[model samples]
Target: MTQTGASRNGLPVEVHHNALLQLLTNSLILSHTTPYLSCYDVLNLAATSRAFRYLVYHTPQVFRHVQLSNVKAAQFSIDGIDRGGETWRNVQVDENLTEDDFYSGPLRGIFSSLRRQNILQDVQILSLDGLSVTAELVHDILVDPSFSVRILSIRDVKNMNERKLRAALQYACRESRPEGTPRLRGLYVFGPKEPAPELLLKPPPPVPVRKAAIPAPPVAKAWNTRSKKALKVALVEAPEPWYARRGDQFPPRISSEWAFTLMACHGIIAFDTVLCTGPRHLNSPAWGTVNIDALNAADVPHYGVATHSLGGCASCGCAPEGWTVWGEDNLATSREPNERRTSGSAISEVGRFPLLAPPPVHSSNIKAAMCPTGQPVNPRSCFPSSTTGKREKACFIPRCFNCLRDRYCNGCHRWWCETCYTGPWATSPGGHGGASNTGADLLLGVWNELP
Candidate 1:
């Protein structure tokens, strides 16, 4: 008797089984390397067979870093006036489309269904912009204990309110935990302009200065004695202080305008280095020099000046001359424009001058030579730019012992501009430093460095 081998019609059953196993193995490997795979891809695989469905459901990285944008409500209506003596109203999505469009309907349905399965925890970064979702919806996602989203970046959100934004930030910060905590490490919220402040008070100091400097002593003397029988003392005049003989010109005194301007300038600087050379008609080199001198006088350290070229003269506009400038050119270059200020020659002129150091040719390999901590050095971080327009009128008031801007309201004890944190509302005015407050007094407190 001939035994019948497993077969379907003319095909052998063992041959079919091997083909199925091979296809399943290949699909599993392909899913690992694919980046930004949409939810539809996973759903299609799941529908292919029960074995494929299991693999798609269990893959963690497939749903990681999900980015969704331009999502609007299906029933929303847009109204526009037409030129043909009629108003045009358009309704794009309806019941028919919802039933027929797999992406707009069935895919959304699948995501909605998976929402209950806690599959969204696999999403590490959720970037939502120009979506019709409300702030309440954002809060819900952030507060959800099961959601593992770590970085939420929402930009160009026109409908978002400050209260909602602040609430969402507070929730994100609160929900973020050390362990088992949603890895929500950062929250970036940006818009065209800042919302009217609930409260605006004098920003805390190191008042913004254009070219703050560290002044060296006027003279250096060495003690000399001729034998024990005859002891002689000599007094030598020290070389000129960096600012000596220069006019009263110095860096701008730190003020609210300075802080805001620096923030604006830094933002421009980060995006394009050429912005440093841009025109500044309002404030001249002398103004910046005075501000720098004030910063030096205040003994506020941690800041450094950047210039086009190193070791160039302060007057020639070629080197970083702190607060000093020689006409249109930098101080050093003005004396001799034809001479090249090399390291050896730089020491000869102006005794010793800091030269402009070229930026790293390849930023990736460039590392800061010195650590910022334990010393006076500006901590460089990626900070947002100011949204306020330039040339916003800022009043500068000189309160003797301290050049304070915007009068301090005694009732509130806070210094304020026309907008917020004005008289009677301030918790503490003249807090940083003034005649009312002692220099050593812990009024404004000390600068806190960022990690």
Candidate 2:
């Protein structure tokens, strides 16, 4: 018997064609392989050697179902649009492409090549991130008779016009799809933007008043909560609160531990525990509880305690002049000793009040700070004295004596009137404040640490 390929126990490989096909078409391998690879990976494999080329080109089943979420478009250029109208003449896949290259990239030649190879007609499942699916490209895909895409998912694509996309999907589901076209079974639209790190974990507080040269897309760092070593490293590297430098401005207050739990319950923060096990308890729905305290106690990564330091004026909400611990009962402030008021060294320790309720402003006593040009400005000028004209505004209307009646912001630590709670920015990047579900008494707010 002529030797083919070696088998176990040092036997000569005499596998039948059917057996070879069965090994290659194993459901477990096929399902597991595509998720960890890019469509370019299949294309590249098809060009590697004669045998691989044949396997990839002939096996439409392997390449037809693709997830373009992990690929980046910047690596490869489209023929006409990005590459100066050059035709795709290369028959070989770039051997230098690394694993990092697997992440999402442009889909310029992906569909075109698939269409030419007659693979597009058989496509049943497709997952596209916002970057891969441009409005124009989506329109083309929907209009093209070749794409029999059954399931479509779009996530975190910026500037994606939902209205037009939905309309196109509706048309494809109703009229544009003809015979041989697979009926759209599901259409899912995930987050319009990537979530901030603070939403999941207590991140290293941001550098004070510092801006990056180039802003990058938000990336949520994965934490292996199961590992204690990983958790220890993450906490050790966490940022400490910085004293306000001469030119720096203070950020918002973070939420209390109890408030964070409430936010977690509302699906605001995507905890790894919640993500892996799921929101509901396995044994009973009512028993579904996130063990935040235990996680924090264990020092698990991203589950650190949320802290808020007292800063600025409690009443007018002005920036503090200087950092000083005046007394146990009250925070102290004053100008630099022996320096004139015009020298810009005014410092004062303002009164500490409940985050929910503001203390009555006594006109006779003001904790004013010196302006940049060395002139004292009343803190009241910094915020709106009256919020009557503004409807649907966020306000911390004091309906009770306790903090329970007031919602606190984990971001600014400023107590907003109830009207400001329901504004568009409530859960947004700059607006990391909780609001009660009811106008009068919902203690809902998260710390806004997102840039």
Candidate 3:
């Protein structure tokens, strides 16, 4: 064995070198093969080997992203394991506080260490509702030139509103270098709705509608009757899926509360079918590139209008001369009284009814002509399958084909369902990964398995 280091510190040279080599090999393998493995898993592996400990100390990049919740302060330590090579040391001591309190502990130290060593490039923090660090704290780490964070997910921040959240995003976006464009690419803000008292104090603005040139038609007597009948039929046919087991239980199906919260915070509305709708508020020129479901046949003639509009297309910027007519038609057709009643009743029972209002006008702009009341045209069709070459299916679930519910198309790298497994969106021959619906199918299976 070649001995090189000054024998001052009590570490054996052979042990140190062995540890270093093991760490380098592990890091290299992990970096390439299992990039998405959690930080906890990586740390656990490091705890098994002295070389791993030294490697972890030198290479902070291994801890690029960390998700810590309600852990004891003692559970955290500068070194993952103790010097004795046996026990794990506890760095902090907080016994009374819950899991959430521990994670929000002035994470300045972790941030500083990562910055100094250049380890953290992406991070996600999950916490309890109503628990969030100040925007100032977030800004300090995210804006620091030394670190590069590409994705940030914060869960359970109840007090954060669109405006404050937007401000924080703007600051982070601004700090990124133009050439590099180091953005917080994927941001997922989640939490329960603020209390009723807070909502009552500041109710959301009413959804706006542009005046139509033609007089509004009288409420259709047939529609009202059909709607009520449909509701009764629906209730009889399928009662609400039991949320929990016979005993106590959290709702098994994703609730509107979760869906709407994600929608309002991230500007993405997720439906039961796994379709994700774009933010209805993002109508300004800056947000024109976002594409969503068409509001109605009258709003946009084609599926690309919303995408073109959001993407800053010159054609969409100029409001078409007769656009309002289309908008009006879409707004009228998009309204499903039966669906509305069901949603309204559900909301009212939870005491969150006041928040429900007419869907925003912007949403109407993307309303596809394929809805039940849609014009006699095809709405955005679902992905085509290999067997059904040209035909497209309708996504009955809340999610769209492009949403996470389906497998990502290898050819186009876009989300697509089984029906859309062929064509240009099909798995490319020499692509990174072939199109596989395993993940999505597993999730669906899990949902089905739920009691």
Candidate 4:
């Protein structure tokens, strides 16, 4: 083990507590040495002794980026964990106390005091890792004095009523007032295999006309049969298949080969990325760059007004600019309602209601998208024999690495359905044995940079 000390003749010299404190808190020491320590390291030092704890606890700026990893539900309380606040009666109470205050206990009182006094008010980024956080805690930490928190992260949190957290944050955003606290700007929520809310599962928009027409290239009959046979043989030898255990919850297919191909193609569940062994790559800096301003800007025509093509109006028999003619056509078309059931390919119209158009996704239904759960595999594992999926390259917003549903990696310019080669905006590769969603964690900095 490595040791740090100032020793004479291989023996450490004893120093007075006051002298040690002076040395540790010296201007040169803090500026030159403390900067070398990470927030985690500083927190560890704070736990070592009272003097160190006093310095670290009071100095919020030094530990601006706080990460509570795998923190248990029991630790959320400040009652027995700290001896700082011994009496609730002695604590100052203003006229704002409500009737509910009488029923609350010491921990709530401690949190109330912390908020009233503005403790942790300067913290910029707060990451809540694990599922132990309660709605009450969320409500307490995100209101008034604690509202300055800019980025709030929830990782691998399961069994959480996300609605409560969302409600609390919405309230915080709406209620920041007299104190002028900054509302939270960025939110990151990720889970390993959690189910998403039903609202996000809107049937994927009717397969567009262009995509429905593209047919897969023909393959030899013998090759297809051989692939199916090989897949069955492989699956028979493997451990319990995830599909068999999950029942019809996963994508449905008739044959074992088709099942394997469908899962691989859609990337419903991926263990290959998690099980691969190699050195992890560092995130590319370019992932931080995004034109959010342009994305959110009102839709605008790229061409100049004069450059627009002219067309003769069918009814008026006069040359009109392309946009004006288009607008007229759109207005005329708008008067006639589109048929809920349109004439299209068999697959395109499947599973849609014949009586109603697909409803728009409202603001309330969005939640974490989850990858399908499946059997783990090693690096040498192979897919169904002779089954090759097409490479997808288009990207979308709010992409997720776990579930390819309705999203894609913006930085990689590839669909989230792929199994390899993601940019920094995607999930962390498994080689480092760190969190699988490191990209989401790093997103705090990117979001905080926004105007």
Q: How many backbone clashes does candidate 1 have?
A: 36
RMSD for each of the candidates:
26.4, 24.8, 24.9, 25.5
Candidate 4 lDDT over residue span 1-451, tens digit each: 1233534444444453356567777644554454345455776887888988887667655544544442232123334423442444323234444323322333344445546645566455565554345555656655655445555555445335556654554455443333443244334442222223343333335545675576545677577767866775574442222211211112321122222221221211111111100111011111213222212212322210011111222122211111111001121111122212222223211111010101101111111111112311221243333554422211101111222222232332223111222234443443221223343433443456547
Candidate 1 residue lDDT tens string, 1-451: 1225656555566676556546546644544433344455556756887766666566665555554542233212234422333422221244333212312332244345557766776766565544334465556555676566654545444345546544554444442434444344334332221222222232235535456665334442122113311321121222121212111111322222222222222311110011111011112222232223212224322221211211221113222222222111132222233332332112111101211111111111111111111211222332324773322111111111121223332332233211121223233444321123222222233212212
Q: Of 2 and 3, which scores higher on TM-score?
A: 2
User: Would you list the C-alpha lDDT of every candidate in the order shown?
Assistant: 0.33, 0.36, 0.33, 0.33
lDDT of 2 by residue, 100-125 (tens): 22222245466666678877776665
Off by over 4 Å in 4: 1-6, 9-54, 72-119, 175-182, 191-451
In the range 173-197, model 3's lDDT, one tens digit per residue, is 4534365443333333431322323
Q: Model 1: residues >4 Å from true position, as ranges?
A: 1-34, 70-112, 174-182, 191-451
Worst 10-residue lDDT window for candidate 2 reads: 355-364
- Evaluation by TM-score, superior candidate among 1 and 2: 2
Top TM-score hit: 2
lDDT (0-100) at residue 34 of candidate 2? 49
**C-alpha lDDT (0 to 100) for residue 19 of candidate 2:** 55
Clashes (candidate 3)? 34
Q: Which regions of candidate 2 deviate over 4 angstroms?
A: 1-22, 25-32, 44-60, 72-108, 130-132, 158-163, 173-182, 192-451
